[model samples]
Each structure stands twice: as C-alpha cells, then as structure tokens.
Target: MTAPSRGGPAEAAPAPASAKPGSRMFASLAVRNYRYFFFGQFISNSGTWMQFVAQDWLVFHLTGSTFAVGVTTALQFLPVLLLGLFGGVVADRYPKRRILLTTQGAMGLFAAALAVLTLTDVVVVAHVYVFAFLLGLMNVFANPAIQTFVPEMVGPERVANAVSLGAVNFQSARLLGPAAAGPLIVVIGSGWAFALNALSYVAVIASLLAVRASELRPATPQRREKGQIRAGLRHVREHPELIRPIVLVGFVCTFGFNFPTLLSGFAYNVFDGGAKEFGFLTTAVGLGALAGALMSARRRSSRTVVLVGTAAAFGALEAVTALAPSVWLFGALMVLVGLLSVTFSTTANSLVQLHTDPAMRGRVMGLYMLVYTGGTPIGGPVVGWAVQHYGARAGILACGLVAVAAAAIVGLIALRAPRAGAVAGG
Candidate 1:
C-alpha cells in the first residue's frame, strides 16, 4: 500500500479533501480511517474506565487501606517511568498499527486473568499489584505508539482537531464507564466488569484491521543509533515551546492528578459512601471533562494564555472542592475541575504535537507520557500517605496548591521570555 504524500490534499483523494478550516470541530472524521479509529476508541475507552473503577474498588475492599490504593496506582504507571524512552524508539522504528494490535491483545489477556481470579474468590491484593505492573509494561510501548498514530490517520492539517476529538471520545467513555460500572458492580459483580472490559478490546482490534493501509501517512523509520534517547531529550530542551508546557504538565500531573488516591480516600473515609457513591463521583468528573473536550474542539488553535489560564482555574477549583460541606457540593465543584483539566491537557497535547518535528514526534511524546504518567509512582505514595494520616481533604488541598504554584511559576517564566510566549502562541 502506498502511504499518503506529505504534500497537499490533492495527493490523497480517498478522504473528503474539501473540509475547510472553518469547520474543524469534527474535521478529522472526513477521513474514513479516522472514523473507524474514533468509534473503536469510544468503545475501548469505556471498557478501560470500567476496569479502572472496578480495580480501585476491589483494592480498597480487600485491604481497607488508602496506602494500598496508592501503591496500586503507582505500580500501574511504573513502567512508563522506566521504559518510556525506549518505547519511543520502538514506535519510530516499527509500524504503530501492529504494535497496537499486539499490546491490545496483551491487555485483554491481563484483564481476563483478573476476572478469573476475582470470580474464583481467590484473588488477593498481591495479585492485583502483579497485574497492574504487567499492564504498565504493555503501556510502555502502547502509549507512545498510540500518541504518534493520530497524525497518520488525518495528516498534519487536522492534527489539532484529531487530538481534541480523541479527548472527546476518551472523556465520553469516562462518562459511560463509571455510570455503568457502579450499577453493574451493585447488581452483578466487579469480576463481570473486568470481563466486559476484556470483550471491548475486540472492537479496537477489528477497527485496526479495517483501517486502509494505503490511507496512512507513516513517518520515515528512524535508523538505529546510540544516544537516541539523549537526542530526544536535547530536542525538547532546545525548544522552549515544548519544554515549558511539559514542565507545567509534569508538576500538575505529579502533584495534582492523584484522583484515584484522593477520590477513593474521599468516598470511603470522608463521605462515608459505598461503591455506588464512588462511581457517581467519578462520573461527575467525566461529564465535566466531556463538556471541556467539546469546547476545545471548537477552537481553531491552541494558545499559551488558554493553557496557563485554564490550569490556574483548575487548581483553584480543586482547592475549593476540598472544603465542600456535602457530597453533592463536592461533586458540583468536581465538574468545573474536570472541565479545566481537560481544557489544559488537550491544549497542551496539541501544542506539543503541532510544534514538534514529525521524525522526532514519537520520542517527544514518549517523554511527554513519561512526565505525564510516570510521576504517579512518586506522587501517589505521598498523596496516599497524606490521606491516611491527615485527611482526604488535606491530601486534595495539597494537590490544588501545587498545581496553582506550577502554573504561576511557568506563567512568570513565559512573561520574562517574550520569544517563548511567541512560540507558545504560534
């Protein structure tokens, strides 16, 4: 199959090439390949979210320890910290579609293992820890491959729109998954939720098989060389636009995005709620994220001000949520927090992908995932410890304060360097 040319839309006639810049909200769907990818991810992400809720609940139930919950979260992301750079090298050297197929299958198998253990009534906290680490190993490769695959489906012209729409699909699943998981766990069982998640992988694998190979715009495969990882690091260090946003994300993600630890602590300890209430809390955040992602889709371009401003608002909202007097009030504030978080994350993701060179995109995204997710190993333990000793409220408050500080520090740096601002705005 012939890859799409890097030139004009005239080179590829399979997709609707007439989609103008004015109608970019769903512009990536004009390509048949992206349409398949979109629907596949929708179903798959929903299943993934269901598993997330079920796993958290199961761990808490088995241990009744908030620190155990944090350990689970940390184990799941540890591989990204260890192998993320190597994963990027593999993504740039191999076919992403093939890599996704392999990794998705491995993930499904892991989910099946968990379901069996739970159904047999023989599952323990140690089993959960082992499975989470294995899944993280798969993600070390899958994350970078998935991140860099967006451009191949829609080409560079619609990359920003494609990225935003991807978020919409993910957040939409986030909404559906928790909503269903709560009732399903109540009526059926947590094991069945894992079974359903395993089944959902079939949809994504089928979609991968159905995509037209000829429609893809694959990057030139990178040659094997020494110091490739260092080269990727140097690339980001030299590019102020990329480095600044990544630094901001590293702080917020490391200190702020410990929701699993925070929410689990809040539901069980603070709110004194059950599984159903925990599900509701997550669903509320998902709804807010969906709204934010839709708003981001309408934007023509991502800017520095939007990224920094939304992050600041998100931090303030999270801080206030820690002080809510009732579960309903806390849930309400969660909506605003979710909205701002997605807005900042989606904008930052697009900014990094759009500005970086195609050949180096995978490596850069590998580093992005490293910082965005790998921090959990460090932050989860700290947040979990705080929740266990102090209170859920205090743990969440610490998250908010750190986010606000990071945004402020990055904002001040940008102001001092006019050229960095220009790069971000561009």
Candidate 2:
C-alpha cells in the first residue's frame, strides 16, 4: 500500500521537498503525498470513465429511448440531491483517507455487481437503475472527500495547482476511458468495461494506504452541533459569494449540460451515428476540458474573475454549439464547451476549498455537489421530456439559454452586492 519508494508503475516518488515555493503547474506533484495520489487517481479515473461509457451504452442497448438514458443518469445523480449535505457531515467527522478507503471499495463492489449482471446477460434497465443509485450514494460522500483532500494534502498556497492537476487527471480519464471503451465494448462487451472499473479502485486504495497520515493537514475542529446539516445550509444561504457558484454549476449540470439527454439525442438521431461517434464526441470534450484545466493552472488572478468569465463564455459557446450544422461541427463545438466548462469548474472548486475551514470542508463540498449533481434529478425529467416533445436542438438551445440567464443573473448579483456593501459602509 505504501507509495513505491522507487520507480514502479504504481509507485510515485515524492517530489523533491526542497523545491522553492512558487514553482509551476506540477509543483505539487513534487510532494510525495500528492504525487502518490495524483498518479493513483490518474490510473483509476481511466477505468471510471470506461465504466461510465459502458453503463451508458448498456442502458441504451436495454431501452433505446433517450429518456431511459436520462433516467439512468437521474438515478445516479439522485442521491447527491438527497444525501450530499449529510455526506459532507460524515466526511467532516471522519478521517477522510479512511472514509475514501471504504467508499472506493464499496464502489468497486457495485461495479463488480454490474459486471456480473452484464456478463450473465441479466442486466436490465431496473438493474442498471439500482446499481446507478448505489454508486450515486457512494459518490455523495466520495466526491466531497476527494475534493477537500487535495487542499488537505497540499495546503492553500499550492491548492490552485493541485486543483488544476486533479482536473487534468479527470480529463485524461474522460479522454482515455471512452476512447478505449468504445472498442472494448465492441470486442469483449460492456461487462469488461465494468470489470475494468472495479479493478481501478485498487490503484486509489493502494495510494491511500501508501500516503503518510502525518503529512495530511488536519481538518478544522468544530463542536459537533446537533443539526450540523442545517448549520451548513444556513452558512451557504447567508454567504452568496460562497454558494452562488455552486448554484451556477448545478444549474449548468441540470439544464445546460445534461449530456446524457442532450448529446445522446444528438449522437443517435441528429448525427445518425452510434457508440463510436458518441465516444468521439466525449473524447473531443475531454480534449477541450484538458485545455481549460491547463489554462486555469497558469492563471494568477482572483478566482472570481476566472469563474465568472469562463462560466459566461461556456454558456455562450454552448448556445453556438446547439446550432452546429454537421455532426463534425457539433463535435468540434463540444470541445469548446468542454474547455469552458472545466475552466469554470476547476476555478469554482479551488475557490470553495480555499475559502472553507478544514472542519467544514467536507460539508461545504457536499453542498457544492448537492447543488451540482443534484440538479440532474430536478432537471433530468424536465429536459428529457423537452427533448422528446420539442426536438433535440430545441432542447439544447433551451439548456444553453438557461445557463446564459443563470450566469447573467448571478454575475449581476455578484457585481451589485459589492456596490451595495460599499454604499452601506459609506
């Protein structure tokens, strides 16, 4: 479990401890703990993406209806709405490494279950729904813990770099997973995709074990409140600056960027293509997202600037993408959309972590996810129905309009709030 002390596929040598501060994008990678996690997560995320692609394909094979695909996505995200706030409370109370160890293992088992069902030809829409829900529940906790863990491992000063690096890792998986899965699913079947994901957990678990506990910065110490969840909500409600971006992300996730509903329709109907085209579209997005993350990594300004601008731009880009004439053009536009999305996402993520107290990090991140992923449940059915009735292009246009409006409203509010405060002070 220990990070390999020397050069090994699994082992990550700690970066030289003595690198003077204010280095570059991968500076945090030099730190032993972060290096271990970075590489481990990189390996595991590839499998995760593969599973994601396979699951989507399996569900589509089972039902062929776009709404059914939306439902599977909905079921997977529903837990974030219901339990994400509470999951944060759990993350705050426990040793994050220990919590991750457990959750990651549970997720692996869930993947295995899906694999069993698929391989045995017993996989049904209902079975996919059940497994997706279980994984969603696990994610309500795992997502926040992983988000907060970066700051815990690398501290605040290097947090931007760490966040960028994490985004890069995620994008790489997004790129590599679907590209590989498209062929693998064709050759072996969806079950192998699920199986690969189950095995990927081993990398993360091993990295967690290898990490030195003493290296992790401690979470904040707070008196355990009787209703901690409510307190967290109250905190967010009272702090628009802290909560608004998360709300924006959720809005985008649900309305502007419900890919399962939006892009699936595009792939199946508008483009007249199948899994390969879909995978190509997602891979193109990953490429753009990787670009966005790299851009954010090099930024040296206030986070609010990066977040607000990128989000607005993303919305604009999505609107244009909705009108793309050809499938190739549509795929190309998606790359831009993906790039802007990651720029906004990574900046928002780093900001939330940077501003939060360690004790409340998990809870705060949980709220972020609740707003981000939870929106899917609330918006999926609506978007799905829209796609069914109106047409996929109209549905996509609507999503884009919603995103643009949210950004405009929120951005104006953010601007006005500061002026209002200044007046009150005067």
Candidate 3:
C-alpha cells in the first residue's frame, strides 16, 4: 500500500500512484477498503457485545449457579488456549478476507442457533456451553486474521492512527451495545438480542464483499517449514520485549477485569438489584472505556505508558468500587474501572501491533490473544468461585488485589528489562 505524506483523504488511502497516505486519525477511512471495515466492524462489535450480555444472562437465569457462568466464560475462551497458536499459523497461510468472511458467517449462525433455542424455550445449559465453544473456535482464526489485516488497510506509518480509529469504533460499540441490550432484554427478551446479533453479521459480510483486494497491501509470506510453530514460540520466549506486555495484559485481563462474571453477584448481593442494574453496571464501564480510547487517540507515544498506568488505575478503581458500600457508589466506581480497563487493553493492542513485523504478526498477535484468552479461562473459574463463597465485595476485592499485585510485578519487570540489557552490554 502507498503511504500518503501530505494532508487529505488521500493520506488515509492505500498508497496511490500519485499520492502519499497521511499520518492522521481517520486516515484509513480515506481508503474504501478500510472505511468499509471500520463501519462494518463498529456495527458488528456493538451487536456482539449485546449478545454477550444476553448470553451471560441466559446462562445465569437457566442455572442460577456462578459455576455455570464461569464455565460459559471458560468455553468461549478455552479455544484460544487450545488453538490460538495454530490459528495464527492458519492466518499466515490463508487469505485474510476469506478467513474473516467464513468466520463471521459461522459466528452469526451460532448466534442465530442460540436465539432459536432460547425463543423456543428449549435452551439448556449444555446448549449454551456448546455454542460458546463454537464461537471461541471461530475466534481462534478470526481474531488473529483481523489484527494482522490492519496494516494491509493502511501502511505502517499510519498504523497508530488506524489502531486508534479501530479502538474508537470498538469502544463506541461497547458503549452502545449493553445500553441497548438492557432495555431490549426487558422489553422483547434475550432472544431478540441474539437475533439482532445474528443480523449484525450481514453488515460485516457486505462490507467484506465490497472491498477490493487490489487495494489491500500484500500478505505476509507463509512459513511452511517444519516446527515453524515451535520456532514462533521460541522467538517470543527469547524476546522479552514482545512477551512482557502480553504477560502483563493477561494478568490484568484475567485477575483485574473479568467483571461480567462478577457483575451479576454485585447486582444481587451487593446492590440488591435486577438485570437492569446489572446491565447499567456494564454500561458504566463502557462509558469509561470510550473516554479512555478517545484520550489515547490524542497521544503520540510508542511505549504504552497508558496501558501500564491504566492497569494500576484499574486495580485501584476496582478496590475502591468494592468498598462503595452502596449500589450508586459502586456503579459510579465501575465507570472509572471500565475506563481504566479499556485504556490498558487498547493501548496494549496498539503497542503489540506497532512493534510486530508482518511476517510473524499473526502468530505474535495470536500469542497475545492466547495470554488474554488463557487468563480468562483460569481466572473466570477462580473469580466465580470466589464470588459464590465469599461476599460479592470480597470477591471483587480479591480480583482487585490480583490486579494490583500483577501491575506492580509487571511494572517492575518492564523497568528492569531495559536496565538489565544496559548492564549486560556495559
């Protein structure tokens, strides 16, 4: 893709024969390929979040067991543990657009299936578990491919802008999805939410079809050598710079910010409210996350200081939220916690994408996703059990403690890594 140097819509477009792609926010939107994706993804992400809220509600209502909630959470992410590494390999070998189309369609089907089951009053815990697993399996391929495809939409120089724009889209969706879902669930029921999610897939598919491949940047060359996956693993282990952030993100996501599972407990035990209150808790977080994304978009930093800072802030926020002693205060603190959580996550994602090379970007991102997904798989169960036995406040406090501890350790490690390098060279 051609990089536009001067200001204009052309700057966001793929390198043209006559123009340079400018480095600015919304730069990728100048290009038709990315513009389609940006809007499509925005719509899709909103619908996905709606489904997430509905599905969790469905499972909780069906079982009334925290363990079941955790299991559902685990099922959605467990595939990342089992197949994320290989999924990266697949992304490298296949055409990303094709992969995305297939996966998005599959995910839509899964959501539709859930809607059918629930609407018919035949939905069972096992069915939810099965659908969660199926969705996770599809994500193993979809997530990595989508991340790797960003550079193709706009070149490396404008990557930060592209990343920021994408973050904005996602954050906006997150904010809108739950807010809409809460009312929709009460009025029409969770089945409608699922149906809306299914319909959302069409937007993404249409966007994918409308984009021209010639406008896309070249794909990374596939590595077909034996033990290639092992080589990828070795590379991550050997490079602390790459692996360090991934580990930190995992820790924060798992221990600090897996709130969907705990939110129900907080609603019932802590706040003594219903589904509306629970949904509002999520909406509060979404609002905070949107603010964080917009703030990050303004900065021009290579290091994700925002991410680390947010991790620490999230831990602190969680702790404060846990001590609110009232529903209103707790909801208010959750907004701050949500903002910190998104700030940390989006910054981390941008950092990872910025530093990675195209050849191994898919695999490297997959590793990042693995740590993220892997963290949830383990953390969900632990957090769920904690809430079930301990009071909701205690469970949240434990999660906060884990976040603070992880942030401190990772912060020290990040600081030390560079000093260690300097010392060795000296």
Candidate 4:
C-alpha cells in the first residue's frame, strides 16, 4: 500500500528509501525520521521502566503483601483489557503524531502528580493504582500509534529491522532504568524516580516536534464508521496466522509474564533483600533481553517454530530459576529467561505486523497488544496468590509449567493448520 500524499514537500523530498533490507542490523536507523523517534522513545521508555520498578517496590514495601503488588499491576492493565479496541479505531482515523503528543504530555502530567504526592509523603497505595490505570488508558492509544507508526517512518521493507531494533532499544533501557532506580530509591526516595520519568517525556515531545511530516509514509486515514471495531475483529478471526500467534502469546504471557509479581516476591521473601537486590535481579533479565534483541535484529524472518520453541525454553528456564539456592544463581538463570522471553515476543510481534494488510494494521496490532499486555493483569493476582500461600518459588514454577503446556498445545495446532510461509524481505 502506498503512503498517503503529503503534497508539496513530499513532491520535493527524496523518497523515504530504507537501507539494504536485511543487510544491516540497524538498517532502520538510517531513516532520519525513525532515528529521532527511536532515540527519543528510548529516553522515555527508560523512564517508564524506572516507574515500573519503583511503583511495584513501593507497593510491596507499603502493604508488605505480594497480593497488593499483583492488584496494583492488574489495575494498570485493566484499561487495556477493556478499551483497547477503540484505541485502534482512533489510531486509524487520526494522525499518529498528534495522538503521541497528547498521550505523552498527559503521561508526564500523571508522573509529575505522582511524584508530588510521594515527595510530600501524602501518597497512598490507592494513588499509585489510580496513576497506573490512568497510564494504561494513555497506552491504549499510544501503543497502537507507536506500533503502527514504524512502517510509516521507514517503508515496509524495513519493518522487521525496525521492530527488532526497537526491542533492542527497550531491553537496553531495562538494564539502565532498574540499575539507576536502585541507587535512587536508596539515596532519596521513589519520588525521584517518578520525577525523572516526568522530565523524560520532554525528549519525546521535542522529537515529535522535529519530525518532517513529508518524510513520513503515512497510511490512509480510515473514515469514522459504526461497525469498524467489529470489522477489525472479524478481519483477525478470518486470518488463521494472525489468530494463532495472538492466542499463543496470550496464554504464555497470562501465566509466564508476571515478572514484577514474581521477581518482587523473590526479592522480598525468597532472597530476603531490598530495592537494590530487586534492581539487580530485574536488571539481569534486562541484560539477557538486550542480548536477545540484538541477536534477533540480525535475522530477517519471524517463524512459528521459533516463537513456540522460545516460549518452551523460557518456561523451562523460569522453572530452573525459581529453584536457585542463591541470589547469584537466580540472577544468572534470569538472564536466560529474559533472553528466551524476548525472542518469543519479538517473533510474535514481527509475525503479526508482517502478515497484516496496511489498511488493517492499526486495528490488528491493537488486538495483539490487547492480548499481549492484557494477559498479565489476569494472571498477576492469581500468580501472587500462589506466591503468598505456596511461596514465590511456586509462582515461578507455575508460570513455567503453563508456558510449556501452551507451547506444546500451540505447536500441535500449528502442525494441523495451513502452512505458514515465513515473511521475507522485511
């Protein structure tokens, strides 16, 4: 599909050609528009990670309840479970740049508000829950805009590269955010983490402001229509390849992706540690994930076998990690868990985007994000219960077993379905 016409400037501007398809791992960075978006979002994403670590740490500290941490996480994703589809429709109908600005600015405000509350020592656990849910509401729109915007910034030929590199950006930030938050949490308070996150959004806003509209290969805006949401779902239902990964990811993630819940429990209970220890464990996962993302960037295709295999390995590793007798062993095992988990995620993301038609891209990605992200909330409290009663070790073991089962089930289904040819070029 061709990008929507930008008229005068577009006519004069050079074609938004990408680097030699899969020849380079960072090919998408060659595109000026994508570079601005990437580096800016990198800064913002690191801050988001900081908030995640601090928020959960604070909640765990406050209630001294594993279930409380789970509940807080569940609240954050509840909006995505409920209103995610409508966000897709909005993404299709509006300019993504505008949606991003509005969402980013609003998020910064929420972070600043949280910071003020925490710094003044007036904050309650309820305040964090409210902010997390509010942030999810923004993400419902921002995620679709961000996910679908990649192909526009760089052409279709560079989508896979862009996606992988984007994962690299995120995972690398994971290494930084938690490690930095560790010391920050000790020196002053968690309030400073929130404050930095609010400031970080400025980088994103400025990057968006600097983007050259004419350089963008924007999609044709979908007109407002009554049955659009329904139509989008039907589109996915009719496509087996799309539906398969979406379902598989939901299952694996629902049980296996409760990292914060599981890790926090381990830090507080099993490992008998504090914020710095929690940060160390989380950063270990990020270290492995960064490696996984970098390796994924060098490849060209997203295959079902790879996705299923990674999920299986990730689950097995999580089970082993749960049994670690020492913090050192747990951290070491977590790196493997992080690596395999990220591989599965990047594969699923690449497969969905590569297979969908541009017209339905936003809506389809919305559904994908709904399942991918929404699964965590449904599982968090349940997993927390296992940790609360059985032990943190039990929670991780349960997640591993479930992920393995899901992979086996999905693998059998994939064998019976029509052949899935790998998406090449991009």
Candidate 5:
C-alpha cells in the first residue's frame, strides 16, 4: 500500500499510482502485491507478538499469579483446536482477499477495544481472557486464508521463496516484538503497547485494500457443499507426499519444539538463570531461524529428502543441545536447532502447498497448522513432567529422539509407498 523503504513509518502510505492497472503491467503489479503482503505482514506479525507479551503481562498484573495467564493462553488456542477445520472450509469457499479484509480489520478492532478497556481502568483478568479468545477466534478463520493466499501473490513458481520470506518475517518479529513490548509496558503500560499494536494493523489493511484484483492468481474458490470439510480430510489422507511431511512436522513440533517446557527447564535448572537468560537463549534461536529463512529463499522447490532429512537432523541436534557442557555451548547449538527447525518447517509448508490441489489447499494447510501447533497442548505438559521427574537434559534428549524416529518412520513409509504402488498397478 505504501513505500517507507524500511527506513521510517511516516512514508508507509501512498504507493506510486501513475501506472494504469492492466495486463501490460502484469509482472510489475504481481511482484508489487507480494511486496505489499510481505511488508504488511511483517508489521502485523510484530504487533501480534507485542500483543502476546502485553497480554501475559496484564494478566499477571491483574491476578498476581501465573495461573490465570496460563488460562488466558488456553482460551486463546482452544478455538484454533476446535474450529480450525471450519476455518479451512471458509477459506476454500470464499475469496481469500475478502476474508482477510474482514478478519484483519476485526483483529485490529479487537486490539483497539482492548487498549481502551485497559487504559480506562475498567479491565480485569476476565476481560483479557475474553479478548484473547476473540482474537483467536478471528485467527481460526484468518490463518487458513492467509496461508493459502501466498501462491496467489507470486504465482506457484515462487511459493517456496514467499513462504520462506514469511518465516523470516515471523522470526524477526519474534525477536523484536517482545523486546519492544517490555519497554512499552514499563514506560506507558500494556495499554500503549496494545494501542501501538492496533496501529500496526493499518499497514496490512491498507495493503489488502490496495491490491489490484487483476494481479493475484487466486485459487478458484471452492463452492459450498455438504461434505467440503470431510472431502478435504480425505484429500490429505490420499496424498502420501502431503501427509508424510504434515505428520513428520507434527511429531517434530510436538516433541522436539516444546519451548515452554524445555526452554524454561533448561533456563532455570541447567543455567541457574531467570527471565533475562531465558530471553538470551530465545534470541539466539530467533537469529538462527531468521538466517535459515533467508537461506531457504534461494531454493526453487521442496523435496522429499530435504524435508525428511532436515527433520532427522533437527531432532538429533536437539538431543545434542541437551548435552551442552555450558550455556555458551547450549546457546550455540540452540541456534543450529532453530535453523534446522525453520528449514524443516519451510520445506514442509512449501511441499504441502506445491503438491496439493488448489481447491483443497486451504483444508490441507489447516490440517497442517492444527497438527503443528496442536502438539504443544499435548507435548508441553508431557515434557514438563519429564523434566520434573527425569531432569531437563533427559527430557530434551527424549524429545530429540522422538523427532528422529518420526522422521525415519515417515521416510520409510514414503519410500515404500512408491514401490507398493508399482506392484499394485502391475
């Protein structure tokens, strides 16, 4: 929607409108659309992370305990687990750009409302929980639309680069958002952080509105049908390439990437540190992930070996990270852990998007997201219990082993299925 050229916020509005929108300008506008999305999403993702940190801070301030904070998080994610499939159905059945406009606008409004509530001294923990749920409810519909919209901006040929760039945006925000939030919270309170976050949404909204309809190669919207959701599920089940990466990612994420449990456990027990130390380790991971995302952008396509091999490497390295003799060593290896983790994620995401029928991409991607994020609810407590009983290193080691095993199992199945198909055909 605009050009600040990554230098200042004031220039973020008003794009060059001299060129008439037509087929001759096709290539330029397509590239421009992708840029708009990338820049808009970059700002939006940062605000999201800021909102997350501020929300947790507010909850703790209100209740004076972490229990309600944990509950707030649960409320936020519960909708995703319950209604995410329905979100995919909506994505397939509607124009993604239109759905995005409504959802993104809704989210920004929610943030602004929350800011007003908190700043006015009328806020409570329950209000935080409610807002959290509302934001998540919006995400249920927004996420699938967002994911499937990627190829439309750049065409199918550049989907991998687009997805990798998206990952880079996320990791950069992951590093920066919380850093910004802490200072905002200390200086002006959580309300200001929330307000700033609300303002950030303008970038995305403006970009979405500014898009030329002729530029995007959007997937043909799936028509409403009785069994669309079930049909999407069946579609995924039938595709080994899609299902294998999805399942591999699910295992790696659940067991290998239980950050809340594993990171906290190691931070306190192994390093004898606190929140600052925890943040240091997290930053290291984010840096590595950012680098990995950059490296992934150069690749033209996703492959079976890269997807499976990265998963296996990610798992083994995670195990090795647990054995580090010092914090320096641990943090260094954790950087590699982050790199491999994002590489596998980007690969898995691209592979799924590139292979799936555009008609069913939304549902398949939705299932993929459910499997990836859904692991935390199951794995976090399990890893926490393991750390409590067996110790942090042992818990992390087990997670790593689980990742390697999942990768190996999926790799075997993928290799065998092709031969199995040949025999069945004969």
Candidate 6:
C-alpha cells in the first residue's frame, strides 16, 4: 500500500521552496494549540525529571542497593509491557485530550501520595515500589495518547518538527530537573522534590484545558469492534517499514536506555561521587539530547539511514563511555550518547507516525511506546545485577555491545532484503 499523506486534517499550505530555514525549523509552533502544549510539557517534564532523580536517590538511601533502583525502574515500566496495547486501543476510540487529562490527574495524585509519605518520614522501599507501579499504570494509558495527540495539534505536514520540538521540551526539563534535584535533595530533602513534581502537573492540566478544542484536527475515532487489538497487531505485522524500525527500537531501548541503572552505579560506585555528580551526569546527557533535538527539528523527513546510523553511533559512544578514565571524560561521552539517542529516537518516531494511517496511529504508537519503554522490566534488573557483581563498567559495556549488535543486524537485514528501497523509504 502507498504511504499515508503527510498532510493532516488541519494541514496548512506548504511553505514555498524559498521559505526561510527558521520557518521550517519552527513550523509546528505556528499552530496555537501546539504552542500551549509545548510550554506546558516544558514545565511538567522538568518536574518529572526532578522526581526521577529524587526517587532513585531516595531508593538508594533507603536500601543501599542498586538492585532496588532497577526494581523501581522495572515496576514503573512493567505495566506498559502488559497493558500498553489496550491503552492504544483506548486512544484510538476516545478523544486524546480527555484521555490525557484523566491520566495526567492520576499521575499527579500518585506523585502527591509519594510526597506525603516521604515528608512524613514513613516512606520505605515498598512504598516506592507500589507508587512506581501505580505511576507506570498511568503511563501505560497516557504515553500512547500523548504520542498520537501531537499530530492532532500540528497536523501531519509538521509532525516530524513537532515531535522533535517535544523532545526539546523534554530534554530541556531533563537538563534542569536533575541539576536542580541534586541541590534540592541536599538542602531540602527528596520529599519536597516529589511535591514540586506533583505541583508541576498543574501546568500540563491547565495547558490541556487552555487548548481550543475546536482547533484540534482530531482523528476519526475507530469503531468498537471485536479483535481490535489483533487488527493493530496485524497492521504492524504486514508493514515492514513500520515493524522494522520498531524492532530496532525495542532492542536499543531494552539494552541501551538503562542509563538510570548504569549512571547510578557510575556515580555511587565507580566515581565515588554523590548526588551532585549523578545529577551532572544526567544533565550532560540532557544537553546532548537538546542538541540532537534541534538538529532533528531542521530535517524535513525521517529516513532509515538516519535511524540505523544514529543507533550505531549511540552504541559506539556507550562502549567508549564504559572505558572513560575520569568522571569528566565519562560525562563528556554521555553527551554524545544523549545526542545520538535523541537523533535515533526522533527519527524512528517520525518514521512510524508519518508512514502509518492516522486511524491506526495510536495503536502503532502504543506498540512503539511498548517496545521503547516496556522492555525496561527485563533489561533493568539484568543491568542492575551486572553492575552489582560485574561492576558498572561491565554493565555499561554489555549495553553498548547489545545495541551495536542490534543495529548491525538490523542494518544488514535492511540492506540485504528485496525491495530495500521501498522498505527504507521514509
């Protein structure tokens, strides 16, 4: 079948060939609803990152176990592995804005509950586990909805730009949140960080409310039917272009994106660093990711070469990072890793959304989020165990090796396959 039109429901006339580069780079923000969503995500994602740092640190403090940290990460994503497809189905059948409002509220409540527990000094490892699981459950629903919602805001012509800008918002928060968390945890304690995160949700909720409902280029809701989930599965199964990149993402995300487990180990164990160093490590990655996002924003299309090439580069950087002799050197490598990571992710994301039918976008993205994040449950524990026994370097090395191997394999398959041009076309 031919690819879906890149123009969306509210798609505007294309810019002229002589249009300025800056206009192309910031094309998506021309839509009013996207601008509100952008600023709101900027604030909320930063708070989310702050809580991430605080939560990991608190778990380590409470248990003094890296395995516990992995478990926390696992609990947070396990629900996505289990229920994400259903969440996509829900996204397909419902208004994404309404789904986001409900899911965002639930997540805020979970953050608030964690904050209360920590503030009262009654928080324990088990409490963190439970709350992490609850948060994961909320994400299972929210992630796919949010992913599909972006196209509705900007229309398909600018979806790639919008996705890259979303990454800019996220990485901006990633840079700020952990940087702030280190000092905040030192001075005020982790509980207040959680409280701040809970309050940050207000920004997103308000933005969702502020968006003009009539302005949204909403997708046609899928009719209720038996075997809907299977239909989604079959759609992906039959489409090599969609499934191939997603398969590559699954491998990379499972093995390559375990930075929480790896960086935590590096900070506490290898570098003999404290909360500040850990925060810096994360911030370095965020900085690199921001650069990558900006670069991706300039691109008009996603291509298979960009996706596979960046994945390979990311893996090579991870391997080099494992062997860095100093904290500064390791942090520097992390920036490169972050840059490659965002490049690969944004390219893959745009490839999937741009190629799929809008009616099926939610389910495809649901699968995308599932493959992207849901593998955490399996990889997190294994990486944590490697760090605990084999050392942080070994754990990082393992991740790099797997990612490189996956990229090589995917690249080889893509090159050797018949109709490679058709499959690799973005």
Which candidate has the highest lDDT of all? 6
lDDT of 3 by residue, 1-426 (tens): 353322111122222334332333355577788899989999999999999889888888998996687688778889998999998888777888999999999999999999999999899999989999999999999989988887777666556556667778988987789778888998999999999999999999999999898888755568577776786677667766566578788888887777877788898777789878886887777777777666555444435445566788788779777778777788888878877776677667766665555666778888888887677778877887888898788888888877788878877887777531110000
The better candidate by lDDT, 5 or 6, is 6
lDDT of 2 by residue, 1-426 (tens): 132121111112222456433456567787799899998898889998888888888988989985677677778888888999988998888778988999999999999999998999988889998998899999988988888788778766667678888988988887888779989999999999999999999999999999998888756545667999887777667666577677778777778767767787788878888967876786677788899887766554335655777778888888787788898999989988988888888777766665555666778899997887788777877887898898888888888888888888778887877621100000
Candidate 4 per-residue lDDT, tens place, 1-426, comes to: 344232210111122455453456787788899999999999999999889889988898888996687678778889999988888888889999999999999999999999999999999999998998899999999999999998889876667678889999998787788778878998989999999999999999999998999999887898998999898899888877788789889988888888877888899899899877887887888888888888788766677888888988988888878779988899999988888888888888877876776777788889999998987767877887898899999889989999998888888888898785366424
Regions more than 4 Å wrong, model 5: 1-30, 419-426
Tell me the TM-score of each prediction against the true structure: 0.88, 0.87, 0.85, 0.89, 0.90, 0.90
CA lDDT scores, all candidates in order: 0.83, 0.78, 0.77, 0.84, 0.81, 0.86
lDDT score, candidate 3:
0.77
- Between prediction 1 and prediction 6, the one with superior TM-score is 6
Off by over 4 Å in 3: 1-25, 60-69, 116-125, 183-189, 419-426
Which ten contiguous residues of candidate 2 have the minimum total lDDT? 3-12
In model 3, where is the ten-residue run with the lowest total lDDT? 5-14
List residue ranges in candidate 4 displaced over 4 A: 1-23, 57-69, 120-124, 265-277, 322-325
For 1-426, candidate 5 gives per-residue lDDT tens digits of 321121111111112345332321222224888788778988999999999999999999999997687788778777888888899899888999999999999999999999999999899888898998998899888888889988777666556667888888899999889999999899999999899899999999998888778887777787888998899899887777677888888889988988767887888899999998788888888888998987776554567788889999999999988779877889899899999999999888877776677788788878888777756667777887899999999999999999999989988887887631110000
Better of 1 and 2 by lDDT: 1
The residue-by-residue lDDT of candidate 6 on 139-180, one tens digit each, is 988999999999788776778888888888888887889879
RMSD (Å) per prediction: 4.2, 7.1, 5.9, 4.7, 8.6, 3.4
- The sequence of per-residue lDDT tens digits that candidate 1 reaches over residues 1-426 is 233342211122222346444465777777898899899889989999899889988999999996687678778899999999999888888889999999999999999999999999999999999999999999999999998998888876566677888889998888789779988998888999999999999999999999999889888888998988898898888877788789989988887878867887788888999766676787778788888887777666666777788888888889889999888988888888888888888888877876677777789899999998898888878888898899999999989988999889888887787654422111
Model 2 CA deviation exceeding 4 Å by range: 1-23, 62-67, 120-125, 221-223, 271-276, 419-426
Residue 236, model 6, lDDT: 84
* Model 6, CA-based lDDT: 0.86
